[model samples]
Target chain A: MTTTEAPAPSASVIARRLVSLHGLTRLVLFAGFWLVFAGNDPQSWIIGAPAVLLASWTAERLSRRRGRDVTLGGLLRYIPFFLWESILGGTDVAKRVMRPEVDIAPGLIEYKIRLTEPGARVFFLDSISLLPGTLSADYRDGIAYVHALDADEDLLDPLRRLELRVADLFGERLGGEPDA
Target chain B: MNILLDLLSVLLILAGAFFFIAGTVGLLRLPDLFTRLHALTKADNLGLGLIMLGCVRFAPDGLYIAKMLLLWLLIMASGATASHLIAKRALRGDGEDY
Candidate 1:
């Protein structure tokens, strides 16, 4: 019988791999998350120990195709911008809801993405859904199909800005201005 | 200082409640599923975030505040992912998956 499955990794190899930088980061993160969620009670550690290890292992396995690392400086800059954008988005919807007339000019805009990194692209799409007046409907090739609440409202600038922000976060370089 | 913090907390909570009401109203009155999803995700998250911020003033320790923020983050990520999936399915109009 032909053996199609690859041999299991040696225990030493597995040990070394588990202590690698990416794995270590996940371990620390999961451990910290457990601590925060379960508090410092010694009794909680009984469950938290195995849970943290399992969580870290699962996270590492699931993200095996991990994209480019995000820059801390980029994240620090992006957080405030993201928060402000979300607030604007929320208020915009609230105002429309409260208005005497329900005003919305919904239309789809084909926005070509500049960021090439997978993680960055996913984050940009998620942010678009939360940004003012825009929700990401689909993605094909390098273009994102965005649904705008108001087609008349300017959509390009904010999207372009967001693309640049995400690119920066992933330490990626874009070729030029967003499509005209 | 406590009194001032309490006043600010109350104001934030009130604003948060207003956004929650707006979300419900929009969900009921919006033209379609996509538009209503917008109301559900954005306004409700903002509402909860504001409420969390208000609660920060009353948190007994930094860890309590961290837990609250973490909860908000989880909700926000889930909301974004859920909205995207729903919007994608609606656009596709494939009920076979359902």
Candidate 2:
């Protein structure tokens, strides 16, 4: 089995820097944020514009350091699905709680993640807790230990989909075994 | 029309309150830490969401609605993150004893 190592910084650094420095993308993001903060107040733009620009610059720097640039389109697609799942999750727990007899078959399950990128892996683990009945209890050695409300719940399929979605957001593909 | 909207808002708020009560019940009655986290995060999030939806109808302007929605989003993010951290810590403790 081939082991995949984290990409070493060499020629890709310049390309990553350029991606992070995409000014128009940053400006558009800032505009959306300003709309949320200042609304249609034209006077507020004086303050909002500069603040947004600074915030976006800081965000760009952070993403650059992580070596992972977020795709706006992917994020947009991910939000609705995430929101829906959260609602479902809430309702599921509420139903179980309100039942005459509380029925829960809790157990710890190990999930083997395919995403090798650190950012993607972190996002995947964080999202697990939000996706109905499963909470990521620990992550070590390429596996996440998840606490499940019901051991029999079909948790793996949604997890795989989420992993793929995160990988797409970061423009990364799952390949090879994680290096030990 | 005004009365109809008001009635809907009241109903939504009541529904949201019911979820909060259910979440509290679960937190008190749940057997373990992880299960309690599930109860708290899920029920509280949905409860707040329903409350936000009800209140948004009463907001006089678009900006107020946006602000309320942003507040809900921030709460959801923090709630999820906090739940994960607590669950992780609980699991680590369990591992050491076992």
Candidate 3:
């Protein structure tokens, strides 16, 4: 039998390849997560290693189908804003509930989403519920039906701002106005 | 310094408890399921967050603080999701008054 000889790849080249591999990236991420959750205990690594591997493998398969990645820096910026909004939302509802008249003109507002990505669209819908006086009721065909505590309140502006923020988080620029 | 930290933690926890009570009041007093959901999510999230903040101040290690923060985040996500589902159901005529 004749053996074909090939040039050996350099160590740096091998490491670069491994780092770029999606499965390996996910494995490293899951392993880090395991370390954190296991409280950095070395003894727990025996159990954590297999569990993290399996979890990362499954997550890799699922993420491959979806194929979207969020910017962690963007997410970090979004959190404080989201927290403040949540506080405002809670306070607004509390005030309304405590008032004697309970003056609310509840109605459905149809909002047309301009974000093209499905992940961004879903996030937008979920986040709407956390905003003051708005709750997302249904989403279909690129349109989201939101229930407003006061129909007269100008929600579109805030919603648009939120859309832009979400777009920024996804490293995508939003184009065009949200349908009124 | 120790006494000051203790006082701050007590204040934070008390504030959190106040929000929890307010949320409960809103839940019982709100007219519709949708409005009630709004109160519950907002109040409870803030309440728990404040409590977690207090706990963070007392936590001996960074890891414990991180875990507490993680718990708060999980609670916020679950609360939002649960509110959405309930609102959706209410819209579907599960309750007409909402």
Top-scoring candidate (lDDT): 1
Q: Evaluated against the true chain A, what TM-score does chain A of model 3 have?
A: 0.79
User: Candidate 3 DockQ score?
Assistant: 0.53
lDDT of 3 at A168: 76
- Model 1 docking category: medium
Over A16-92, each residue of candidate 1 has an lDDT whose tens digit, in order, gives 65789877887888888988898888899899999988886656544535467888899998899989988999999
lDDT of 2 by residue, A1-180 (tens): 112354444545534543555755776866776787777889988898788767765654445334466688888988898879878888888889888888799998888888877777777887787787887778888888888898887777777777788888878877865321
Query: The CA-based lDDT of model 2 is what?
Result: 0.78
Top candidate on TM-score is 1
**iRMS per model in Å:** 0.8, 1.7, 1.6
Model 2 Cα displacement at B9 (Å)? 3.1
Give the DockQ-based CAPRI class for model 2.
medium
lDDT of 1 at B21: 97
- Scored by Cα lDDT, where does model 1 land? 0.84
The candidate 2 chain A region of ten consecutive residues with least summed lDDT is A1-10
TM-scores of all models?
0.91, 0.77, 0.84
Highest DockQ model number: 1
Off by over 4 Å in 1: A1-16, B96-98
